[model samples]
Target: MNVAFTSRTLSLSRPQLFRGIRKVQSSFATCSVLSANRAVVYTSNGDPSQVLSALTFSNLPPPPPNTVNVRFLLSPINPADINVIEGVYPAKPNPNASLSSSGKGSQDEPVFVAGNEGLAEVTNVGDGVTHLQPNDWVIMTRQQAGTWSTGMNVKPQDILKVPRSLNDVEAATITVNPPTAYNMLHDFVQLNEGDWVIQNGANGAVGQVVIQIAAAKGLKTINLIRNRNDIASLTEYLSNLGATHVVTYDELSDKSFRQRVKEWTGGKNIRLGLNCVSGKPTTLMTRLLGQNAHLVSYGAMSKEPLSLPTSLFIFKNLTCHGFWQSRWYDSKSSGEREKLVETLVGLMRAGKLKEPSHEILTIQGSEGDEEASQKIRHAIATLAKGQHGKKILLKMEETF
Candidate 1:
């Protein structure tokens, strides 16, 4: 499939893109009406390649009270999204979505749209809504908001308005990995400047973000990745992102590397450890932490269970915790969510954070349903086989 890859740079000249919505208004102007919409959906829990398909339906009517109609600008195909389609994820999609009634399935066989993270533009607002207006950019606040579609009607409360200064890629991909990195660095541990953080999977998306954010805050990071043929290039790339040390799992497994890590940190305690690939390597990571250090795990790319010696917990006073961005969103109110977005946007503006390296998989509105469906399925299949290293952002245009 022909796809486009690009990383958008920050543009600060257009801040007015995000304003308005001070008080409840009696009436709001709406944008040009779109007549048709399309989405990628699945009817059963199975391999995305076999179960996923493209769905087309009539444009959603004006939203109900307290809700707004939104046109999705861009959505991402994340690993968790694939897991959700495979029925292995904890969070499930809302099966009763109005988009299901497009005659694709019935009550006996409900159709569910795929996608959890995206950026959208408000096209219409219903009564009793005050915080948003047509054309304002927003992102889904609820898990499984069914964002892999051209448009949908969503409750205003379930979406958070974001700055327009952010490019399509930054806004679409911000909801998951960035927040995971930011919160893990800030919430679980009280890290001071000149401190040390060690994390495996340092070349992955979230790991890259952690390296930059920690560097921005004046903390040093020891990044670890799997040994590969391109080890030298990868290490140099991460070093350019402010990683103090970039070593492979092979180097980490060496007996003398522990003393080298000690010397690198000037014998200071490594107070924070982030693990996404859980297994023997992670256990080795825990052994390098200081007393009272916190170990936060977010993913298990290796699919191996974490097994750590009890001596580390007992003698070193180590603490282990799990982090999920969905749970963090569920625990915060709208105001708090807004603050989190605001803080991230500030970092973007200050050049401390950036849009992830990504490729655009555009499902053209002009294409036939079968053609579109085949493209989406092929992309998911490729991702499942670990072919694409950059993030995949889906651009579902409104059907004319």
Candidate 2:
């Protein structure tokens, strides 16, 4: 809500005063976020607990030509984001001092801001911008743009306008997990109504999205998750989200489970398998696939190498591949991205898709450096524990 108003003074001549008035009007007319901006910055690559800090930049300038000023509303704490901050991610952020308004940080070496995905609102626009206006909602189109901040200034094309009909959580999360599920489901196999697909880590964010998307496409999912104390509740949750079948890792080991899957699919071929948890879970999922079935591995949460029996490839003719949503996005054009978003938006509006359970961590906009750093540090610590099944989101704007 930080904004500036233009005022006229009588001490100046008509020509001078008029010129001054226009200058002030041009900067303030769009309702810019004129206060100091805050961000979570890191100077060196290491654990987030050791290197991350909060910084405030003062006297921020307005967006330049063809650019728009964006105030962040929500940013999700993805595991990949933590990896980026640790310098292990494949895509690294570019160092730029202009990200901070205050003349702080070394000119020779710059710092990096954290977070990858989030939702933002446009607060001001440059002269040549036409696609977006003040108060418009948007999401980052590219990764590694440093989303954990109060606000930022960028070109209009860098963000995609979000439909007002979608809520903060839905809009904030659609860029990653949902798209990963959608792409993996469509790109690897030609599935039809009632076609069965089996996947490990079915309780994870991507797995949940996979269930919903598969259901919307009239495909069935054999969802597998880790055995938790609240196994029944977790099973019910995925079932409510349209999972055709739900089983825990323990149940997956049961000798009768193969027969159960057979009865569930009515002996029909399960053409696709999605493996996120590697090691034994991946091998187990691969065994369930039918002839010439596709097995796509996207993540190795167990940090275990996939053990594939040669017999599956030689006898069953199983097709194995891997998927990374970031790579897919990098290879595609903006038009392709738009098409994917449009399709997901339609499904969401039609109630065929829904956001998974998530938790909101409110980061105060006015906290001091030490206070803000402590809050973020505690949040990161909590994230590392993975205590909750809900996705952790940084709710930046107070009103939200």
Candidate 3:
């Protein structure tokens, strides 16, 4: 459904405020006349393929004070995004949004846009916004910002300006996986240069980032993945990413692998373990840790409960903690977030950080609403079936 835009006059006392208002008003007028926006939206929490639809709407009106209008360049479809859509995640979308397929909405019905992380360019800034201007690149710092749309109005505090040097893919994905990996490594334990780290699901996006960051820090990683047919090739691929050793869950199941791990680390204590795949495999990995080691879990890819032996905790002094990047963002200020982004960008510029392998699913403005909806639904269906090994990014055309 299309939204209608209306202009409002602002009462400004300062000269700078008047100038900002005029600039915003002019930009808003142009956008109201020329722009059409579309979003992947759903009314209720359920299977994305059944609930999600392509919603075409008028461009947003002029942003209110302390807000900025932004056009999203790219947004990634993270596994967490799917969980959020299914209503299984902790974060919820803002339901007060005025959106509908028929250009009308009742108080009882609320529309939810789907997406959390994205790269966007500021198109206009409202009065009282001085740090951002037109064409500045930014990434959402707010959880569940509904980034699937072509454009939206956001608070200045909810977004952080990123360096233009970062390519679209890197900027789009920088807000989530990389930060998760970076924080888990630094926040949990203080590892020496030759220390060892162990993790399951090591070929997944965050795992790969962990491997590279660990390697850069001169720490070793014992990477774990599920047994697959192309085991040798996968090992080689992860090894090149600086994984000291790549082991399958089958190998981890064997009792002798613990001794092998000891030999790999030269009998040194494995100080930190990262777990995304919980269950018996995680318990097996935990057994290999030395005294006072920490285990940080960020995800449960296997949807299994993390059950660990009590003996390990009591005898070995093993510490267990849960991590969520969204929580991390909530705990930090905008300046702190900016500093983290700067560190990641430096890593990217220095070749220490590389973009995750991804496929872009483009929704063209030229396509009819049904055609676009079908494309999104098909992609979500494929993801639901575990068909995609790489990340899937959504690139929405502006003129929808």
Query: Which should have the higher lDDT, number 1 or number 2?
Result: 1
Model 3 steric clash total? 1
State the displacement of the C-alpha of residue 107, model 1, in Å, after optimal TM-score superposition: 3.9
Tens-digit lDDT track of model 3 for 188-217? 888879899999999999999999999889
Q: Which stretches of candidate 1 lie over 4 Å from their true place?
A: 1-35, 100-102, 105-108
Candidate 1 lDDT at 121 equals: 98
Q: Count the backbone clashes (under 3 Å) in each candidate.
A: 0, 0, 1
The estimated TM-scores of all candidates read 0.90, 0.89, 0.89
| Best-to-worst ranking by TM-score | 1, 3, 2
Alpha carbon RMSD to native, model 1: 10.8
Q: Whole-model Cα lDDT per candidate? A: 0.88, 0.84, 0.88
Give the candidate order by descending lDDT.
Answer: 3, 1, 2
Q: Model 1, 209: alpha-carbon shift in Å?
A: 0.6
What CA RMSD would you report for each candidate? 10.8, 6.8, 9.3
